[model samples]
Target: MTDSQSNLIDRYQQYRTRRFLANESQTSSWLPGWRTQKRRRILVGALLAIFVAMLAVGVTCHFGVEWAPLLWLPVCLVFMPVWVALRVASGRQDDAPEAVLDEFEIDQRNGARSIGFAVMQSLGLIAAFYLIFGAVITNGDNGDMVYAGGIFTLMAVLIGGCTPAMILAWTRPDPDVDDLS
Candidate 1:
């Protein structure tokens, strides 16, 4: 091979070596600015609050809480997961590197962002469902188990919000020489 070609290959290899070392030496740090911690705290807090609220509603219903007030319970439950997912996904920076993509960096980024937006938008549809169900339950003067179900549903939505981050982090691409090629 020509000297110039050898030098080019050497430079490329050097770059790849540096990147690999950097990746290897770097600890898995959380996102900067306490955002990661804050997000975690909020997620936990939301879950705890939902649990407490559900318990209260359960006890009240078991005893004698008014059915009208209880109607909102389902709404809360149903909306929780959607809200959590929206909050988690939306709070992320648009340019944030969700996962490394040597071959299809743009495609992966675009897909992640698109998925993030879709999750966020679903919140509106969920909220609408909550409102509609809430209205119907209240209007009919019903106190059925549906309200409890709704509140639980919301909690599930909130829980679902945490998945994207976890999945993104878990599936993050590893450094490869070809990636730097």
Candidate 2:
């Protein structure tokens, strides 16, 4: 290559390296501020709280069709994975490289996030369908169980999965080059 071309290549490479390193250094030590934490916490709580309230209603009223509170239970299932993710992925941030999750943990979290996204997308579609055609029902005995059980389950799983996945995506540090592409 010509000297100017070679110089240009070198500069680009250096720039890339410097930029990558800068990202690593900055993100590695990044700790969420109180305000950010408060916001995320509120978001998560609000998202999950609706499901919990529904659950309380279902239990309190014995999942009655008249109350139709039982329908809320299935919708609340997404809370499970989100809660797990929060527990597993919490406390991950520091200057030390070892402070971050290893490849396996990172991969697992990414996989979970992907699943969460898919579940959430599916929930959106389901909601749209329900809005257009009314809640899913069939010859399944008075339509209450189908509405409360099937639709509720979908809602729960979506909320539960999406909440934690969002929290992780927002709060977790950028992965090291070796751990994630």
> Using Cα atoms with residue i matched to residue i, what is each candidate's TM-score against the true structure?
0.33, 0.35
The residue-by-residue lDDT of candidate 2 on 81-127, one tens digit each, is 44433332333221113224577666656665666667677766765
- Location of the lowest summed lDDT over 10 successive residues in candidate 1: 27-36
Full-model lDDT, candidate 2: 0.50
Candidate 2 TM-score to native: 0.35
Q: Residue 91, candidate 2: how far off, in angstroms?
A: 20
Residue-wise C-alpha lDDT for candidate 1, range 1-181, written one tens digit per residue: 9999999988876776666446433522323232344454555455456556655664455334567454555757654673444334333322333232354654655665566556645754664565567658678454444454454455445434544543343344333434222
List the lowest-lDDT window of 10 residues for candidate 2. Answer: 90-99
